[model samples]
Target: MNLIDTKNQLTEKKKHVEKVANVENATFMNIQLHAGEEVAEHDANKEVFIIVRKGKVRFIVEGEPVDVTPDNVLHMVPTERHSLHAIEESDILVIQVKP
Candidate 1:
């Protein structure tokens, strides 16, 4: 069992990635982005779930653009390509389930 205070991990960097949890079956991460910062398109090698924790973000998934706000949750398969752009300062949790 683990208890983490994700907000305390925030950083002033344009892009910050923090490992929140990891076990044999899954990995969890906290991603913080300042306005104008982005995570370039990439493929997730494992099934992935993205949870928007604060502010707003523009998500480009396989060439399609979708706006996301707090409480929005997105699911993607291993082969999916995606990217995220912060419309405002944002925080997101990324969970990847291994096969």
Candidate 2:
């Protein structure tokens, strides 16, 4: 079994991104962001899933704004253009699945 620890990686002052696992069909990542921080818009090459572990964020997907929190998850189809803005200090897990 492979074990990944994420709690220690969360930070409050700066943006943090780490690849926690890379397996045959998927890549797993952890992302932390402080309030007002944003990830520039980009296109996803694979199917993508973002799970908010804590706090809240605003997701701009294909020019639409989506508010996401720990209560719900976000998914995107391959090649979808998207970006993230931290509404508050937040932590999230991102999974990319290969086709």
Candidate 3:
């Protein structure tokens, strides 16, 4: 089994959001976002599953914003226009299934 501690990656970035693929040959990734930061406006390349771990997140889906907090799982369909904001120093895991 392949395991990773999401917060312990040595390459973790200090600014903005950062992502790293942890599973071997699997279309999954672990993403981290800094507090008060925003991933403004982007089109999804695939169906993405977002899991919030530490803080809160707000997602803008098709112009409507939804609040996502810790322990929340969010899904976005392929090619959907969306954006995300970190409410309070969030840690999110994004799995891209159809990229």
Q: TM per model? A: 0.90, 0.93, 0.78
Candidate order by decreasing TM-score:
2, 1, 3
Residues 1-99, model 1: lDDT tens digits: 579878734454458898989999999999998889999889978999888889799989999998878767888899899988999988888999999
lDDT of each: 0.87, 0.91, 0.73
Pairs with backbone N, CA or C atoms under 3 Å apart (clashes), candidate 3: none
| Prediction 2 global C-alpha lDDT | 0.91
Indicate the TM-score of model 2. Answer: 0.93
Clashing pairs for model 1 are none
Best by lDDT: 2
Candidate 2, residue 73: how far the Cα is off, in Å: 1.0
Model 3 CA lDDT for position 44: 64
- Which regions in candidate 2 have their CA more than 4 angstroms from the true location? 8-13
lDDT of 3 by residue, 5-85 (tens): 666332456533445654443366655667777887997677888888778889999999988876668888888899888
lDDT tens digits, residue span 20-60, model 2: 99999999999899889899999879999999989999999
**Number of clashing residue pairs in every model?**
0, 0, 0
RMSD of each predicted structure:
1.5, 1.4, 3.1
Error of 2 at 88 (Å): 0.8
